[model samples]
Target: MSTLELECPGCDQVLELDAGFAGGVCRCSNCGTLMTVPVEAGQTAEVVKQRQRPARPDRPMTPGEAEAAAKADEQVYTTTSGREVRVGKTSIPTAQQKKRLMVRTATAVGFISVLAGVLALAGMGVWMLSQAQREAGERTVIEAFEYSPGANPYDQRLANVLGLPLAERVVVVVDASASSEVWLDEVNAAIGAGLTETSSASEVVLVYTNGDGLHMHPSQPRAVARWRADQLIAFQQGVSTAGEGWLDEAVARGMQWLPRQMVLVVGREPSEGELVALERAFEADAAAKLDVVAVDFDSAALDDLTGTYGGRYVPMTREQLVRWRER
Candidate 1:
């Protein structure tokens, strides 16, 4: 027998038996209580099954039996929530039900895709903004445009007034080859970028060369590189800008410049003379760490010289300069 588990809807008492036994009064096993379990009129799975089967040629239900079967066919699956739910083979799914399921699935997928896209865009935006902010916070700027050779130039005059501690110095190298009206501002910008007033110490020097190169600033705690800026400038002013382009010599002169831990601001690639001079200088001193940090103001000219001895090369853009200065 297909046993069914049931409950007394009134007394909360559990009963286990066939639904066919739900005829009238049922005696409760607990508390010796008697209860009435309602059975739908003429409704049973057997009755419903008989109604659905086509009549056999040899045998058929009687008139009353046929009437009871017809009534049973109307029975539905009743849930605990008191809703009539279709459960058997006669309950074919409708087009409306299929359409509703499809719509729900599509909507879920679309919503997830949209959410993922939104998160991806937000992540990318945050990453880019964070990087730009980081690079922008590099260093502070200062003006020491006092390197002009004559008339106690504007830059020199300002330096004298500020009398900036000898510890903080800017070195400007003078070139004998050519005068650079187009590139002077660019070189100045690069050099200015090195000026910082943080816990780290910095001393500025202006290097110059007509035939021989000079590297000088003032007051160093170390015994190395004591060349004075004014004296070097005086020597460069006499260098006839007639034979060579000033910017070329200036870039070449950069390699000859001093201040082991100072900035070497230049316009172009160092000339052959400057390279030979550098090799000889470092070769001769052996233990002398003639550190040169070369910064290229001209973006077109930055490349690894000989694929070795890679010096510090910083390429500055106008926009980057403005952003760096603002910080």
Candidate 2:
């Protein structure tokens, strides 16, 4: 067989083939471009123009070129054995193409990682807010029930001035002056009814207004005593209405125990000097509260005084006291 040398028209690369391969299609070894071999030696090969080939000198075929080459019709040629052989285009990726694919994959993975981190941070913030709210709720419950030791649990009442539950430390100031003699029995009944509701845990002090000062039960300010119905009756039996009493002095003396709440039962309107003295006493103890239960009397000064201290001034009539005692 005669050897033939042909130059590929696509890449100008020289190819050596046998004369038996004349008029047959083959790919150039240097550029992988398909071309038709000539019949004689020294003839230039014609490029098989199945599709426009991309320009890539001294480099591997790009992915686009490889795909185009694969889609082209398969070339059939007769080998030296006289048997027909089929040749199909097969694409092999270049190193640059492999590197670009790896870069794309890494970018996708990095984006997913960042998204997961953001989600985790948002979840943690929600958890922290929930924890704070839970702690605040617990603190509210604890503060609502906080009371002094040995204090009556059943006698607990919400302070109108503080808008909070009162502690076990309580002082009841009764107006036992000559002006309150008419309603003194009703006041004692009301006080006894209230004290009957107290449990053994209660710590109470009864302060009655004397001629010009205040008289406290048990004589000692630091006496830890639980007053019941019997003790309230005994305290009232001992009290005798004589003359006009000093309201300011009685309230000031009630503050000596530093009671959390004080209930004042007054049958007469407070004087200007007494209101001023009451306001001063209230200012002295910011934590202490004064609630006035006015019996058969209502004064704007007394109302304003209780209002200034966040306390309630409730006026009660004879009929109302009767109904309360009956209840």
Candidate 3:
């Protein structure tokens, strides 16, 4: 058997004429340039003057293809006669292409996620602004009422103002004077405003002492206003005094019974001696955390006591005490 060798005219590459390759297009081994192998004799071959070419290691190839060529160049084959042969091959398309597809898919998903987050943030901002605007468009209001008393309208008003819907500690001390019948009207009016019927949430400690520095009912213990309102009023009226002022005496007498609370005082101030006694007792009691408030209807003598002991001294005027709660 004989074999024929052919040269590619386009790239000057060498090709071989196989058994079925004569008279047909054959590929060049060096350049892969197509060349028509001359099967017929006396055929004019198109030729051009070849310039001196620069020495190159191999044909044009990518890194992967060069690695494949290097691997192929390293292959040794034993001939049937025990000889070695080196083979060179061109690279083909990769069979496993899933990795490139996955990378492209991951990049596209990341872009979509960023775009969604931006849109969500903008939507939340718009919703919050809308809610705030709606809230600002709504309404706000407060309710208020007035109180009046017979002797100390401000004190009764103070009771009503402070006692109404009362939440914290509140204690009231009323003087059972000859004018207690008139003063009970003030008490009833305050009850009409807002007083608990049975709840002693506030400790109502009443004073039935008389003027002239006398303890009329010294044996009777202090009682809640809801239960002893009538008794306290009667106790005040029954024990009439001979111009005797028990104002200071009452505070001194009541100091031992004092507890922690905002107090409401009723009736007029007692005589100077009694008033002095009351202030001394209050200043002492204040040290024990008791708040003393005196509501003087007959006279504002209790104002000095109220001021002296840092307790509230409401004037007899309704306008004055009503304004106090407002402020």
Candidate 4:
């Protein structure tokens, strides 16, 4: 049978009736109003229909007469505004969870800290080793500055200044000015003596600053010394050209190689700009602890130049040349 539909007279709520109970009185589902179904003309009084519910096979059924009986059993609390709220029980964390989180965080932090500390120590060790090597190299050169055998008093002092320790790599810059011609032979001897002491050198560069420049390759210090002597002899024979000396260009050329190497300059004064550049160069190589030595005619100017680069200036004596032939 089709269902019957009707609205409540008091609340106008729509309600459905099973066709089996067409002429029935019932309460409205929404407004709870007592309502009467429209009966046939022959029927007089309204009838009430009863609904039968099936029995539950699994569990006992609760009566639906009260609204509270159909709700879940939960704790209800009344707010200050008189509204009730229901809540279920919640769980609290135990000591184990908190301790586990703390341990993991501490472990991560400690691991990172330890790694950083190890890297820092490694860097420091490398720096210390390099410094030690540089100090040893400098000491070797300074110790080799002892007085040569049978050298004159003035020549001996000059030799002390000129006899620098040759490093693994060496750059020898010679001033080829007219005024420098007289002591060129002594300069040549000092170069030879230094070279003899630096037998450990792998490469040697000789630069003569005359007109433009003269360069010699991976040569022996003794060979370059002999060559300088020959050039001096040739100069005495009036075979050399007369030109202004460019010591600045010679120093710049000497610094073209690797940093932290040895440089020996026998020359006149370099320009202030060149002196500044040389200072920066040495400063950059200071970490490597290289040596720079200069022997010049102008003692004061050489002092300033050497001071700029953390090097010392040694005064040259012409008397050194008298015993130059023995070397």
Please give, for residues 1-327, the per-residue lDDT of candidate 1 as tens digits.
333344555456556533443333345554444554355521342322222534534568789776655555543444333344332235321111112457778999999999999999999999999887544432211232322212111222222211121223333443433443334343333333222212222334455433433433322222113334354345334434333444344433443434232234344466677666555544543332322323334422333432223233344344443343343
| Model 4 C-alpha lDDT versus the unseen true structure | 0.49
Give the distance in Å from residue 200's predicted Cα in candidate 1 to where it truly belongs.
5.8
Arrange candidates, best lDDT first: 2, 4, 3, 1
Query: What's model 4's lDDT at 267?
Result: 50
Candidate 1: stretches off by over 4 Å: 1-179, 189-201, 209-259, 286-310, 317-327
- In the range 1-327, model 3's lDDT, one tens digit per residue, is 123466556655444443222333445555556555454521222222222323445678778765654764333333233333332233221111113457778999999999999999999999999887544432110012232232332233222323332212333444545554444445434443333233232334445443445443324332223444454445445555344335555655556655444344455545667656655765666642333333334445655555655544544533434444343
Model 3 lowest lDDT segment of ten: 138-147
Model 1 lDDT-worst window of ten: 157-166
Best candidate, lDDT-wise?
2
What is each predicted model's overall lDDT from 0 to 1?
Answer: 0.39, 0.62, 0.43, 0.49
> What is candidate 3's CA lDDT for residue 43?
29
Candidate 2 C-alpha lDDT tens digits along 3-70 = 46667776775566644455665666667767765555423323233344444447677887666555
- Descending-TM-score candidate ranking: 2, 4, 3, 1
TM-score attained by model 1:
0.29
Model 2 lowest lDDT segment of ten = 91-100
- Each candidate: RMSD to true structure? 19.1, 18.5, 20.3, 21.2
lDDT of 2 at 239: 86
